[model samples]
Structure formats: C-alpha cells, structure tokens
Target: MPTKELSPTELHLWNIVENNPEKIAKMSIVKLSQYAHVSTATIVRTMQKMGYGGYTSYRESLKIRNNSNSTFNVLNEADDKIRSVITKNEIEMNNTLHNLSYSTIEDSISMTKQAKIVYIFARGLSESIAEEIMVKLQLTGKYCEFHSDPNIIRTIASKIKKDALAIFITLNGETDELVAAAQKLSKNDIPVLTFTTNKAGKILAFSTLSFIGYKSKTNYFPEYEVRSRLPLQIMTRIFCDAYSVRANFYKSN
Candidate 1:
C-alpha cells in the first residue's frame, strides 16, 4: 500500500488498529475515536490519508481477511531476510512511481527553467536529495543555492527575490523551520515547490506545486529515528533527469 509518515496521534491510532484489527472492524467511528482518545475528525482524516474513503470504508477494509503469511515474519535464514528486505524496497519504489504525476513533473521542470535562481532547502536525511538536485541543476548552468541549516533557510526565504524559486525536500513536511520558510516565501509570491510524503502537510498549503511520495507505514526500528528515504530518492532522480533534459534543450535552442 502507498503510505505516508503519520503524526504521533495518528500513529497511536494506527497502532491500535494494527494490534486489534478485528476489534477496530467491529467498532463505529465514534466508538473508535473515543477508544483511541482522539476526535472523530482525526479518525476520519487518518483513514482518508491511508487511502480509505472514510472511517466506514477503513473499518470495512479491516474486515477483509488475508490468509497469507505475515510479511514481517522472522526468517530463519539470512538469505531469506535479505530477499525480504529487497522485496519491501521494490514495493516502496513501485508505489512511489505509481503515485507520480507526469504533468506535475513537467510543470516543475518548466518552473525551474524559468526561475532567476533556484533555492533548495532540506534538513536531516533530506539534505542529500536537495544536494543532488543542486548539483544536477548547477551542471546544467542553472544558478542554485542549497541550504541544509534551518536558520539559513529561514533567512534566505525572507530575502529571496520574487523571481526566485524555492524547493523543499522533507519526509513529513511538518518541520517547523521548513514550514515557516515556505509560508514566508509564499506570502512574498515566490514560487514554492515541495517534495514530501505527507499529503495533508502544512507545507503543501504554501507550495505553488507539490510532489507527494509514498512512504512505508511500517516502522522497522521503533526505538530509533530511522525511516526509509527510498521514495524521496526515486522522486528526486526523476525530477533531476527531467529538469536536465529541459535545461539542455533550452540551451541548445
């Protein structure tokens, strides 16, 4: 399933469903919301974000049974575990590709080609993807500024010109610094482009164009702060390649 990074509350609700699927399937939306200690709206929104029509649809989906073995089974053999990991990654990439919009990509490339300057901002693991974009654009003779620091991103956002373009690479897309920067740039009428896993993220509201990517809902390491960056990597590769083609074509003309 194509998934997204969930908020703490949403994650808590998901945990309940994951642990007690039959129980959730039996409960009404109001009952589930009360049991989960969240509002009915939260329940509906979380279900919708998970690709369900609403709470009713999600509950119905839970009722459908699959007799196959659990994908999270602890494999006895090392090779089996390796294959499992590979299979999961393949699924992740496939879902992300399926979610991509060709027209949105073409629009992003066109905006990049027309911008006076391209400002890229990212934090944590997302910085690598932003750097890749910067390097690719720079190689095509486009002037790009890449910032990984939160303070610098906010500062640049405030001072950036109207003709400049801003791209934000974030997994959850709810980072305070990044959202603040996006809001500032948006208010100034700067073109903002964002790549994120969260379709309901605040940054999307400020974005002139947004690319949504799929993230695995499974948290393999619940104790650690690790999450897969595969979706972002795949989307970045596509965007950079398309932008490069357009940039080269414009130069040739």
Candidate 2:
C-alpha cells in the first residue's frame, strides 16, 4: 500500500490509477498524463522503453501487476490472519465446490435410477467442462447432453420432459439468456442446477440448487497469472467421481 521505494515512473502511474481505476482503465496516454504528473511523451516513451507495445498495453499490464501484488499481500499478512480470515471469497468458493460435488452426485444417482434425461448448459471456458460432465455422466446410460449456446439450450429446454434435470454453468451466475432457459425449464416442473460465483443471484432462484465460487482471488500470483484450471478441473473430477459412484450403485441395485 505504501508508495515508498517505487520507481518514479511507477509512482506516477500508480497515482494516476490508484484513485480512479475505472477512468484510468479506459484512458489514453494523453488522458492519463492529464490525470497524472507524467507527460504524454513520457508515458509513451517510458512504456515503449519498458518493452510495451504502447501505452495501452502497458496500462493493461498494470492491472495484472496489481492483481499479482494483491496476491502477494495476501500471502504476506500474518499466517493466522490468512488462515482465519476467509475474506468472503474463500468461504463462498469452498462451499460451492463442496455443495456441487455432493448434490450433483445425489441428483445424478436419482436421475439415473429413474432414467431421467440430463442436460448441461455452459458457455465460454466452462462449456468444455460441461461437455465432459455430460460425457462422463452419459456412461451411466442416462440420456445426457448439453449446448453452450443459448439458442440451442433454449430449444433443448423446450423439449425436455417434466422429469428431466439440467445443470447450467455461469461462472458469474448473471447470464440472462442462460438463466432464462433455466427458468423456462423450471416453470415446466423440470429441475435446474446452477454453478456460479453468486448463488444469491437470480439463477439460484431458477435452479433446484446453486453452487457459488469466486475464481478472482485464486487466479493470480506474483510475476504472472497462475491459471486456476487445475483446481477447477480437480473439482470437476470430484463431481464426476461422485456422480459415477452413485450411478454405478444404482445400476447394481
């Protein structure tokens, strides 16, 4: 938090960005200079000399640098503080992973036993994971499928029987189109499950269950962005395993 020991250019840029990242996040070098003590040429030259393509790339780099810095600070604050202070984030994330794995398994088992149709809805990166979930759950011989596009999802939702279940993945839990499809399914007496960062969002109300996780705090490190793909992937594995075990048990019974 202290500005001490920062390079002169770093200090200037920090001062400009620290007060208003919203505006700074959208500024050109000329605008940035008007907001800071640094000049336009100084901004461009320093940025290029620092190996940036231009001021914009350099400004984007600052956001990564700041997130990394926050992660560092998170690691530095007393170990006890870090341990006990779940920061409203860690709590939500861990809870989400736990609840999803358990409930999804239960749901999968019940669906399998009853031969209920399954569908998954996820866009963006998690769409791939949803595909995998569908495939793995498909091994139980339940008719499971998913589509990443809202148009396709809506079509499927319309045809899903009243006994079917769907799991919709929205990392932020605020996708209007995705939640709309989920809502449509719910209105027809179908069950919906949601995976997101905010269970309290409208998706939760639309779904039979909602899982919330914050990927923000866990995705960066000093000097680089350490991808959170592993943790997310591992959780996905747990979910599949739980589902598989339950599904197999039902088959044997």
Candidate 3:
C-alpha cells in the first residue's frame, strides 16, 4: 500500500497492524480499535478504504494469513537460452501470482461486463497490447474501442458516458498524455481501469480499479535487457479469459 493512499488515522492503524499482524488475527475489531485508540467505525472505514467489504472479511483474511505455511527455493541455473527463458518466466509468474489482488481483478471484470462501452488507451508497445485486448473482448461479443492517439483519447474520454469503462495500459503509469486522459475520465465520473507496474504512481490515484504487474528492472546493456513482458501480458490474458468465461456462462444460462 502506498503512503499517499492512507489517511492519518488509517496510517496509524496500519502501523499497528504491520507491527502486530500475528496478534491482529486473534483480536476482534473492537479490541483492535481500542488498542489503536480509534473507534470501531474507523476500523470498518479503514477496511473499506483498503478494498475489503467489512471487518469480518478483513479479519478472516488476516486469520487465513496466520495459517499459511509456504516456502520458496531459488530456481537452478539453466543449460541454454531457451531453458533460461522458461525458468525466468516461471519465477516472474510466481511473483505476479503472489502480488496480484484478486479482489481488484474481480471488480475490474464486473465493471467491464456492465459497461455500455469499453475504451482501451495505450501508447507505443502497449498500444499493440491494447489492440490485442480489444480483439479478445470483441471476439467474445463484447464491444470495445482502442485509442492510442493522445488527442483522440482526450476527446473521447471527455465525452464518454459515466457508464462507460476506460482501460489504460502503461508499464510505468506516468505517461503524461495517458494521465491527462485519465484525469478527464475522472472528472466525467467515468470509471478508469489501469494496468501498470507495481510502482506507485499518479495513474493509480486516478483509477477506479487497478491491476499491477511485476515491476521490471531497468535495462543497462544488450545482454541485460528487460525485454520480457510476461507479467502484464499474463494479467491481460487472465482478465480477458475470465470475462469471456463469465459471458459464456451468462449466455448459456
């Protein structure tokens, strides 16, 4: 969680939880609130703010965490480039699975399914990814529009209906044009969905729902180039596939 996302009271409560996560699983909300010197309402509000439905859901999650017993081991060195690629992708996929917020993904899928129109905005290499998303959704009989041009994006975003959905794909989430377009959508009361690197950025602040891919390190040389986009690509595929399955189930029923 980003510091910018937390209120002063929430931050205080979060600090306590961070320092005493194991104890939190055993403590009731009332006890936790009392210990933090805040009201139960504060605790409930904090849970909602952090994307949980309520105290019970959040508490149950904490309890589940306390019961988890997982271990990790480093991958062995590969004998060839092909083997190395597979090994690295496996590691990155695990990282993404560990870091992903399924609640957020579900929320995004719900919004997309309900939206009157879906607009996908991206630039450069991400524009191709956006087009792929558009095609995937369209193939499933979902209406989608793709926009990579800044001027066109701003124009459409300003005019889109509140019931429409805006999906922005940016690796860093700091592109000036995309951020400006997101702001426009925000002002119009349209929901903005974003896929970006795990680093905290302004775009996430503008998003109604957000998904984070594993962060990639900076490339320094040809041999060390961070060329793989498996994390984001995997997230995109999962979302599209999930939505398609849901759509089919609804139609079948």
CA lDDT of every candidate? 0.76, 0.59, 0.72
Rank candidates by lDDT, best first. 1, 3, 2
Worst lDDT 10-window in candidate 1: 71-80
- What lDDT tens digits, residue by residue, belong to model 2 across residues 1-253? 5556456876677666656766776765545666786544344444434555346555565677667332111112222224333543454345445444332334334433443677888887777778887888777676887788778877888888755668776766777778788888777756566666654677776665444554545543556633333334545666667667755633444
What are the clash counts of all predictions, listed in order? 0, 0, 0
What TM-score does structure 1 among the candidates reach? 0.65
Best by lDDT: 1
Question: Clashing residue pairs in candidate 3, if any?
Answer: none
The superposed Cα distance between candidate 3 and the true structure at residue 87, in angstroms, equals 3.5
**TM-scores, all models, native as reference:** 0.65, 0.53, 0.65
Flag regions of model 3 displaced more than 4 Å: 1-86, 218-227, 249-253
Error in Å for residue 48 of model 3: 4.5
The lowest-lDDT stretch of 10 consecutive residues in candidate 2 is 70-79
As a whole number from 0 to 100, the lDDT of residue 243 in candidate 2 is 63
Looking at model 3, which ten-residue stretch has the lowest summed lDDT? 71-80
